[model samples]
Target chain A: MTRILPALAVAVTLSSFGSFTASADPLPSWVSSGTKDQIVEFVTAVTTPDSTDYVTPADRIAVFDNDGTLWAEQPVYFQFIFAMDRLAELAKQDPSILTTPTLQAAAKGDLETVLQGGHNALIEVVNASHSGISVEAFQAAVADWLDTARHPETNLPYDQMTYQPMVELLRYLRDEGFQTYIVSGGGLHFMRVFAEEAYGIPPEQILGTYANTTYEQVDGVPTVIKAPGIAFIDDKGGKPINIERTIGKRPILAGGNSDGDFAMMEWTSAGEGPRLGVLIHHTDAAREWAYDRESPIGKLVDGLDKGPGMGWVIVDMAQDWSRIYTGAN
Target chain B: MTRILPALAVAVTLSSFGSFTASADPLPSWVSSGTKDQIVEFVTAVTTPDSTDYVTPADRIAVFDNDGTLWAEQPVYFQFIFAMDRLAELAKQDPSILTTPTLQAAAKGDLETVLQGGHNALIEVVNASHSGISVEAFQAAVADWLDTARHPETNLPYDQMTYQPMVELLRYLRDEGFQTYIVSGGGLHFMRVFAEEAYGIPPEQILGTYANTTYEQVDGVPTVIKAPGIAFIDDKGGKPINIERTIGKRPILAGGNSDGDFAMMEWTSAGEGPRLGVLIHHTDAAREWAYDRESPIGKLVDGLDKGPGMGWVIVDMAQDWSRIYTGAN
Candidate 1:
């Protein structure tokens, strides 16, 4: 789609911050002279008219990876945790549902056993917990879990575990005429349950790994029921492919924390004209959980090594963020 | 995703009509006593605050079918015609590419023979013409086709065959805070090429049938190239399923011209609160080509038989539309 300039630019500011003033800093949670400066510089260069890097508002598309980029992904992905909890809940009602060894391990909260079984095992756990229900019911289940469930370590609500500075950045980008989308490896239905409230991104803008669904008429009402199979996994190479398939335009900016997002960042960086690839490096142990290259979940080896050489910005959480979780002590 | 009302509403109107006024009419191409009045009444009921049928702006999503709903699908689907032309162009370069009978028939413009070969044959013709190119290159090819390809019967550019009243309807809905989307069985990439230019809808808002794609690094640049396999067909039951998977919300209104879109209208009508299902009955044989119920292309059996009984607005193109093509005499 060839987009025209200026006409697509509307004053529909999505800043959670109050009306922007000349002196008001949009990203108040970000410390100066680090990732904040990099972001500001890139946005200004692309948005400022008469600059060679100027991009039209219609082409100002930005994508973000959810788990470790926008929020904390320690121990394991939050969606994986949600699946475990849901499996346990489902098993309590009908113990026979826990047939497979992976399902049994996941339902019993034996994370060690489930993790030992590998990626296929994790997918089994997710499919068992996530499927065989109506899309609305599954979303309701997720919403219910988020309402009561708390992180084992921080005890913070999963939705509230989102990074304060990252949320601020999302809002800041939207204010700069960029359409921000969450292109993550999280389950599409799982993320859609709380993404709008958590990150100010709508469900339509949230693209992620999804399960196969079948449309059926239940009780005289048209319904889409989740089925027991993975449709597409929006991770690694799949990220860029899904983005192109859905958005049809190469995003100008991409953000992620793990190697799973490397393909998306690479794709964005390779696009013509002004581009920015942001990688959030986990370095703030005291404020937020810190794990990087060797971490089982959200391992950052590729990003840490290759991102900078690709002119991508690697954000140091310890040095760049003045705040971690929103309103955290 | 559960949407919070009034807050989501913004003044991001996409009206090509100068400005809204009490005396100014929005649908000038539509005759007032028919489907236009049905649409106006429904929109007014849902949008007016304090009304019994009032709905939030966030829930005001309307979907339209492309081939026959938004434009004319006379002799056959326009995309099929595009495929035939594209196959001819490709065969001109490499004769061996036309190995199959379907390909040969399509390249030679023998529509009768191609049609006799059935749906699989059409798919073969399409996949052969549409794949093996970078997404950008394929879109460029489509743009080129729309620029030069004229509808054989009308001698008008293919893009110009769009209905003016439907265009106005899309803009009016957007002006009233509805997010209008094209949910068609037409090729996703093909529609995205001209959808924004012809209908004011961005690529992200268009959902349709898509081919399998592969991500590869071509000359060190990340590229998505179309492959020769049908990934998902966005028609019939697939329409509602795709909508649920992609948008994660049931649309409030759906407009289509045939039974292929029946599932979409059914899904929209079954949603809670104010709903509308619009079926465009092609009845203008004098002004425009018209066929229904028995026409192989855009056969309208289910929509004609059950739509009115379901409270769906059956738009009589002859009576309801004062004009067919945007600028046609």
Candidate 2:
């Protein structure tokens, strides 16, 4: 599928990212470093017809993990914060919800105490805040929240807190004929709300954890109600499973930031021919929150240790990225 | 996103399907009939920027159901035949499988008796035949079977049994900048093997029923092993659910051939803009096997009955389609 070009022409195309012209820098936010070079080299190799690693445009699938990889997950995941804020609002209205143990922890913003309840507690919070409403109502609610809600640490809207370098990488990939997809652990609808505006990935290409939905006719209007139960989890090993279930082909490129992404990376790297696995290590404390290997959310211990041996690229945020937050520059 | 082409240019573009020339017939196999005209009208309206019903190219999602609609599903669903053939092969190797009642029924090609055991029995058959194998191995098996297996009645390869007119429609829509997807009740991987080659729809765009898969390492190789459990069922109410789960947006156009597609049609028609619901009624018994209303497989009762009231285009196969099968001149 690759059109033959002269070596000089190929070099010009590689240097140009957004415009696809001769001299535009695709990853301007990305510093001229080994990590950036690695990304460019892999993309160029797969897209070049004469290269042994050439892959067709139809097969140029790139999956990205959302939480920490695309945006900040510090001081608890942004979705958790949304759920907590929602719990607070609901508690004020219901009053009775305040007495429930799990709801009480969530209302108090005590995620640690809520964690004591384990996976069920998280599911309960997610269900209470995310489900039982119509899909439209939920989407509207999320839209409203995201419009006003600011990250506690950054004081910027959650959408604006998306990493600048990563955003550029997404654009660059898309410019190069790769169909970019967000294979996130976040709620499917939650990501769909801002994915197109933030990442340039359309809703159809966004695969994520989803709640069960029931189809029904309400007053002559067809409606899909979000049911109060988890349908599919798009995390850890489930990531690879969901990718296969949704995409039907093994992705040539995948990026993530935690131990949860190890299996996804493993699955992508294990595919035949050329494949690229990227692990984003949060090592910028001054610019952005830096906690890895021991962080409660988005831990990166096993991935950091195993990535090098597996030929996966470990992107040290502080060193590899010239910019962190999109809001910064 | 539609450009305001000159009236002459618009007519030329519409006439030319593949080359975008002035004289090529987009639906050559499709007779110059009302059904074909209706399709052309819908495509033009949606693609015309000046038209009130105009939709952007990004939102121009057209979903097609496999089986009876796109291909022949007369003697039995092709996938079922593959399963039966696989069961026979397995039974020959392991005589003990014949001792089990469901396996015995499957091996004898008695789907009715196997279905009498209910949904669980069907799942058991699918698992016994399709699971506990690596994804690559399963794909290879399906590929090998497709290469040799012939339709019992048609004696044509299953892929060749596709409707040439419908194939033309797929290309026409794609040429008009619409993204085509196969939303089928067939297994996800099963449709994927032939979807791209037959319909020009890639694996990522193919949405269907899927089995659960587990990610694991087998002798230092990463593998996604298909587990012995039904992950998702993409039929009836499940179709709308899976559509939202996978596509994240309601499609503008949907085509199907059975009562199983009613909810999908309802979902598409209920969306906020101009939408089209197409029900392909099998009425050509001479050229193609005709079965509807009372047919055990691919039943078209409710859809044929309720489709007209819902503003759906009920395509009479004998009248609307000039050609039934691809193999037929």
Candidate 3:
């Protein structure tokens, strides 16, 4: 574990042109108050060696839940949107899957109908579209799709649509020697395939939902074939357990934006040592979209009610964040 | 990210009984002549920044096969031995299992009979014992068992019975900025529970076979409940895919001592740059048993045949290494 912070030069960017213009500073729009001060103070107190809240580098683990917290999850969860597109493409050949309730729902672009039976039905469709292919072929296919896939509403390429502040936050925390991990309700394999290219997070460092895959020797060459089973579900309550199971060390910092992340933030706040939990409230109605409590996507009203008791930091997106997306680079 | 290499004093035999032992050079005993020379040469060549073969520190990845490369897997693999012990202890409650053909065969302790069906049956016993348990409970159980579990022939605690030379080798390479990973055929969850305590390697760096597991909300607590299915088989050809899939870099250094590891070394050697492959040939019949080709456990005939042609360094246990087990305190 070597710190190369001093050796590497800090990159300074002054507003580059793209889908969205870069500002002089990322937090221009964020309203400052005790809320912002608390966050900055917390990070300073824990990270500084002299502070009472100073934590050793080993204990300085931070985890972030993706989707709504880091990026736009409108129209539907981005992955579900991708899966739906994939399902529609596959529906051309397998017309019979449309007869099945789950596949029929997905093909009909009905979220309730598709998620009706849940696990069994979703697995059937995922297996139909995602499995029985070589890993290389799968990776290339995903790469190609990701290169061209644009969000239906935002018209932003999915990758570019990431929250700029969170990306900067990830880099800033890493600069302070905190190992960052993404503990999401997303597919581990899919996230892993893009983590390095998209976020600089490596596969081994990324923990999420998974399926059992096998490696086989065929025609004197080795190939890994995806198996037909669910291995781990890294959503909701499973977040903390997966973090424990995979990383061993409990994170001192955790961030999220939904009830699905409530357990994670709860676990992080209750940890014995110094901890930080940040919740991104969907209050930005103009740029992106906003919904909570009654909405299906990223509901977090309970989280806000329960957060203060647990020492979680709630960031009203409208006031606390200056920027929304990173835009295309 | 502090590079504590200077502070990480190497372990040596303590001069008397002081808590702080005088540090020996973290370097190994093998004189830079044959195998050791080849290894050091390859590592140096690849890591030299100005050289044509120079690889970045990120690319200076090294993978090792655990079973034969790091420890003994003679009469039976240690984990299987642990499984056998677990099964026998459980047999008291279900005595009929002891008399049943499968359980009787298992209890008799003849590994051939115990694994009569194949790897799937082996996993069947393992899953029941390892899954649905608290992470702490599983870890404590492993630590407790390792404290007392001894090889039948040597009667030494399996933990202390690890290959001392290889242990030193790991430190030596790590000191030189090589990130080492243990690629093994053992159960992933099982190995993960103990790898850090036994080997000083982080859980994130350990790759192995796994069974299916799921996340569950139990009494409002998040738990990864083990499911009844095979996930990934991190053995043979699977080793390379797992390495590439997990590590995302071609190793500059690789080591193993079995046909199961041949694919891993081949994958390493196939890269178009300076790289080293080492096969640990157990040749000390006096200190321990030795077998290859015909042996079910730790077979190395294929690795031996292809090693020289592939520019791999084969280290004969009795010849290249001066010490067998240092029994590091």
Q: Which structure among the candidates has the greatest DockQ?
A: 2
**TM-score for each predicted model, relative to the true structure:** 0.93, 0.92, 0.79
Q: Candidate 2 on A179-211: residue-level lDDT in tens? A: 999998899998999989998999889999899
Q: Rank the candidates by lDDT, best first.
A: 1, 2, 3
Per-residue CA lDDT of candidate 3, range A127-205, in tens?
6566666566666666777788998777888878888778877776776788888988876667766777667777667
lDDT by residue (tens digit), candidate 1, A196-293: 98889998999999999998989877899999899999999999988887887899999999999999999999988989999999998888878988
Model 3 chain A: worst 10 consecutive residues (lDDT sum): A10-19
Best by TM-score: 1
The global Cα lDDT (0 to 1) of model 1 is 0.90
lDDT by residue for model 3 (B1-329), tens: 26665344432223333443324444455645577777767766776778888887777788998887887887777888887776676676766545446555565566787666676556656654566665556667777788788778878888776777788788777777888889999876667666666667887788887666565556875455556666778888888877765665668788998899988888788767787888888888876667788776787788888789988888877777767764632
Number of the predicted model whose lDDT against the real structure is largest = 1
Poorest 10 consecutive residues of model 3 chain B by lDDT? B9-18
Question: What tens digits encode model 2's per-residue C-alpha lDDT throughout B51-101?
Answer: 999999998989989988899886767887888789888889887766579
- From the highest DockQ down, the ranking of the candidates is 2, 1, 3
C-alpha RMSD values across all candidates: 7.8, 6.2, 7.8
True contacts kept of each: 0.80, 0.86, 0.31
Candidate 2's displacement at residue B252, Å, is: 0.9
